[model samples]
Target: MWRRRAAVGVPLQEGKRVLSLLDDDGRGSHLFLLNVAQAGEAGLVGTVLAVEAAAHGHGDAPRFECKVSFDRRGTGWRQSSTFGVRSTNLSGGLPADGFAFVAPNPPPAAASVTITLFDISSGEPGSALRPVLPRSRRSRTRLSATTTAAAAVLLR
Candidate 1:
């Protein structure tokens, strides 16, 4: 959930348009432009969509995707994103880059309007991926990447 703002944009080439967005408008400072079949007023909104896929990443690592979809014609439209997170090496950390694109105005899915962006992120790696301290400060927790084991430590 986020603030909704209208977009002010000018036309580019045929089927192409450019628009502006405010900070975190789509969850980041970037606004994605789409090529629409027909031109009209446009705006941007932010959302978080859970995208899970098989190991389609380099080294067969897991992917952590970030998405930014559009509400075209006031309906649900989107541009999907993909991610690659490898924590096998501690020095590498679980690095993740931003991705998501799922909006094409008009039919054919060839045209795009414009949309905002949200940031993408992943965490560091450690034992069982890593140990997370409970906010209650009463226990410590860990989750195995393989999901075969989970651990929790009670702290007093």
Candidate 2:
């Protein structure tokens, strides 16, 4: 039961803003910042924030996957990247400007994860952004969970 605050608005540039995720204790995992361009072209232009996980090699660390989408008046570009398990407490930068999205990998079974857009200049979070988890991915997770449960039962 991780408690997280709603997305906060951060100004990036004219007609553009970012949203950031904060936790109840003013801490958050998987923080993201979006940079929207003036020509309506947006991109992710931030770095990955520190989010302490349960423990390393205990299967408690959180997984993350980020995707960016660009819409240029009909033509669009989409790119995605998934964070590896070995990637922990690491800092990385995103593109300077673009429309992008970030999500928790292995999406929570029942809990909701927050994705925020933050402005680098103002140092504040902006509106909330919802990036849907693909149905196929969700199903795969369910299957894996069921399989793991069955295996544990057998071992017992």
Candidate 3:
């Protein structure tokens, strides 16, 4: 059976955070921190963060790593990138003050990837942003595409 794996990261400290990712076999995935969390911060609790996902080839070695960062335009935290089969850290604590996530390499072609800035305090992960969100982006993009296609059809 083809199965999909997922991971959720919660910042326990400034640089340190806990990653709870699921393996394809439905086992507990590996967890570590390149940079330990700092003390006296909001941590992952109720904080906005990003998420990324990717798939490389098939069996092992090409694991997915999610990197989080604050959005551009001084907006909010959002998923910056996803790299295949590499170690990463949420450096600088989810990219405050208009920061970005830097990926070491390009992701796989068949990889499913996304970055989400979520506020867990709302009882829903990735559900507190206003003005713009991933869904909004999709909706707006689809709308624009539809409008363009309609106009083209009418012109034809």
Candidates in order have lDDT scores of 0.29, 0.27, 0.27
36-124 in candidate 3: lDDT tens per residue?
Answer: 33223322221222232332223324233333433323343334443332332344334332222332122222322223222222342
Candidate 3, superposed: residue stretches over 4 Å from native: 1-13, 34-62, 67-79, 85-156
Candidate 2 lDDT tens digits, 1-156: 222222222333333322233332334423332333343233223233223333233243324333222222233333343232122322333323222343323223332222322222223222122222246743433212211011000000
What TM-score against the true fold does each predicted structure earn? Answer: 0.21, 0.25, 0.27
lDDT of 3 at 69: 34
lDDT of 3 at 7: 25
RMSD from true fold, candidate 3: 16.9
RMSD of each: 17.2, 16.5, 16.9
Distance from true position, residue 141, model 1, in Å?
A: 45
The candidate scoring highest on lDDT is 1
Q: Which should have the higher TM-score, number 1 or number 2?
A: 2
